[model samples]
Target: MTETLPETAERLTVNTAPNWRYMLQEYDELYRYLPAGGSDKIAGHQRRVREAIARLLKRNADVRLQPRAVKPVTAHLRRALDEGRTASLAPAVRALDAVAEDLSWQYGYEKVPKGLSQNYAYAELAGTRGPVVAEDIILGVVLFAPGCTYPAHAHKGITESYVILSGAVSENHAGVYVPGSMIYNPPEHLHRITVGKSEPALLAYAWMGERENLHEQKMVFTRTRK
Candidate 1:
């Protein structure tokens, strides 16, 4: 039987770290976009998702790591384990779990010089449901440190979307997005994201195609030595 939304939310909450509440809420919202016939049945699902988020928020204060510097010229791609392989998404999930663990220990944010930043990704569908279409949506989290700028970039076949899980993010096309906000980048739309002060920012995103071809463009800017 198809699992009920509440049950699914509960399972997700129980399995993830405390910081994942905001991310869970994003998934809950995605559920809302499902067909309307099951709305009532899913009400409990929404509640479970909210409760999970609340639990996570309450535990946020317990996080103790500090943000690290991200250099402009360095590219921080935590290579995907499923790259060039037709394996199941399980490896991708493990990769994300590993990244999350590392991020938690090292703090959520990483500063990438003026022109670049760090990224940690996990592909959920690959492990659980196998590949679909030309690609499958990979779910992962990205942390950004203050003063870091992610140069403009675009994905050719893949459209991407992010849900702000913590802190704040300033996007060139979408403006500033605070926690709980969502942003969408249609296929091939050039854009950039810059982190702000106060704390490291975390966002949950989905890469919609072959991970390799996802990034089609990067921002252009003149550089000067400090």
Candidate 2:
């Protein structure tokens, strides 16, 4: 049986759950900015994002996850603000930003290595501890160093969207997306991203579906010689 703790003299409990209502508020905002009929050709991607969120809620059914874990979701939702889906995802992005601002907490960054002296900052949204709300959005940020190649990869059960904020990054999806551009990845679409020029490249990314449960098949880089 689960042990129950007594309340403090001040009437406060030790195991208070995180503010899920607030989380939902942000989610509502994000939904407003997303594209309509996002699930039409991109149903799988949306499923993955939702699945990841479901897993998080299941794990942290009581208390809130640490601030660092939840912070990435805001960025992920923000990235969904590209053409076609911008109208539906706008409110959600605003809500997420508000939550981040209210919490006054942010997650740390890590490096995704591409090659020697080339790397990108990655923020994980679906780990042991993260924000738990709806099961529809996997959020994160990618920061690319100048001239860095992110290599080709494929989304498993979700579609991905990237919004460029700073510098220049090239995305090879369908063809190529230049700086100040946005790229959308349909489920299982193979692609790569590389930074351009001397400045750093920053982007917000949102993947729709259950990333943790789904297995992403890695695409071989045939152009690269071993």
Instruction: Give the TM-scores of the predictions, in the order they appear.
Output: 0.44, 0.49
Q: Residues 120-144, candidate 2: write the lDDT tens digits.
A: 4454332323343323454544556
State in Å the error of residue 185, model 2.
0.7
> Considering summed lDDT, which 10 consecutive residues are worst modelled in model 2?
10-19
Clashes of each: 11, 26
Model 1, C-alpha of 188: deviation from truth (Å): 0.4
lDDT of each: 0.43, 0.47
Candidate 2 overall Cα lDDT vs. reference? Answer: 0.47
Where model 2 places Cα greater than 4 Å from the true spot, the runs are: 1-118, 125-128, 131-134, 173-180, 210-226
